[model samples]
Target: MLLGGLLGGALDLLYAFGFAASRGVAPTRLLQTIASGLQGQAAYEGGTASAALGLFSHFAMSLAWAAGFALLASRVGWLRQRPAFAGPLYGIVVFLAMRCVVLPLSAYPHPVGFPPLSTSLDLLSHMFLFGLPIALLVARALRR
Candidate 1:
């Protein structure tokens, strides 16, 4: 679970950071945005402290996702047998749950909207970078 979460979280953050950089957004600002999930708009004004909190929150969420997947995969044989297929699908699931359910229920200050280009990229990143690594790592570890 640790391995999967760490790898998946790191990859997810890297993709996010790269994407933000391409659009001229600083990593600190991105982190602050994440912190806003829990701290609301005040996170943006909290500077480095909020950014750190956001980073911690990101990893915590990743780990929770990893642990949940690991638990389910351990009991579900098909998941272990089909890492590549299951992983991407799981990523999609994660994305949907976060965007549709989680965010709506969280302390996020803004309403979530699906703005085509960014939404597509975000979905692809979750599938390929976040979910894929977690599923693959968990499958490998459990099979041993």
Candidate 2:
């Protein structure tokens, strides 16, 4: 689960940076925004430290979601039996958990305000880049 989280988080961060850059948003600002979830907007002013924190926070969140799925997969035989299908669905679950619960209650930019295209892209990324990797990795662990 830890390995899946780390790799998936790194992959997701890369995808996020590219997505944000294409939209005229600075990558550093995006990283800072991750930290903002915990430190509020002031995290942007924190410079390198805040970016570091953001990176850490991002991985922590990924790890948590991965752990959650791993726990469930371990306990639920049906889930372990169908990674290809369940993975993307779990990604959607992770996305909703963040947008509806995690981000809403956090201090990050309010309302999320993702454009239609961006929103779709984010959802796809979560499914393929985030949740799928975690699911596949955890599934592999189960096989072992």
Off by over 4 Å in 2: none
Query: In candidate 2, what are the lDDT values of residues 32-123, reduced to their tens digit?
Result: 99999999979989998998899889999899989999999999887778888778899999988888888989997657766799889999
Q: What is the lDDT of residue 21 in candidate 2?
A: 91
Q: Report model 2's TM-score to 2 decimal places.
A: 0.95
Quote the positional error of residue 57 for candidate 1 in Å. Answer: 0.2
Report each candidate's C-alpha RMSD, comma-separated, in the order given: 0.8, 1.1
Instruction: Give per-residue lDDT, candidate 2, residue 54.
Output: 92
For candidate 1, the TM-score is 0.97
lDDT per residue, candidate 1, 67-124, as tens digits? Answer: 9889989999998789898888889999999999988898888889999988999999
Q: Which ten residues in a row have the lowest lDDT in candidate 1?
A: 102-111
